[model samples]
Target: MRVLDRPTFDGWLWLDGYQLNKKGDAVTRRELFVQQAGLRKVSTPAPVPRRGGRQVGSRPSGQPPLVRRDRG
Candidate 1:
């Protein structure tokens, strides 16, 4: 992602990037609104990992993934 504009006074940031679709079949340009404090500046962009096969940095086998339940 690239910073499209300076951060707002309230700490919101505007970003532009090409993101993969949910099915990972397509890429589209998108604008994102995110908190500036949640972002970290990286000296270099990391390589995009290939999809499928064994999951990288994932939980051990046989362990169920954690799910967040929202209390409405």
Candidate 2:
């Protein structure tokens, strides 16, 4: 599965079609290859903003807005 050249537009090269290589097969093989390769689409989990009734915008001291410095 080598991309011979860059796409005409920039985004993501969605694997929605089949491709032929050095072999002589000409049949569309996208689904077959994806299934064989155990590849599937997945959804990413959303970030959990706050927990235990803690406000995401303020600290427990009830002072000014808390700055989110480190996300690491």
Per-residue CA lDDT of model 1 for 1-72, tens digit only, reads 777766476878889888775555448888888888899876954556657766665777799986778999
Clashing pairs in 2: none
lDDT of 2 by residue, 1-72 (tens): 433343434433434445544443446756222222355457844544443566556576757775668777
The candidate that wins on lDDT is 1
The TM-score leader among the candidates is 1
Could you estimate the TM-score for every candidate?
0.41, 0.19
- How well does model 2 score by local distance difference test? 0.47
> What's the TM for model 2?
0.19
Regions of model 1 farther than 4 Å from truth: 21-26, 40-72
10 residues in a row with least lDDT, candidate 1: 44-53
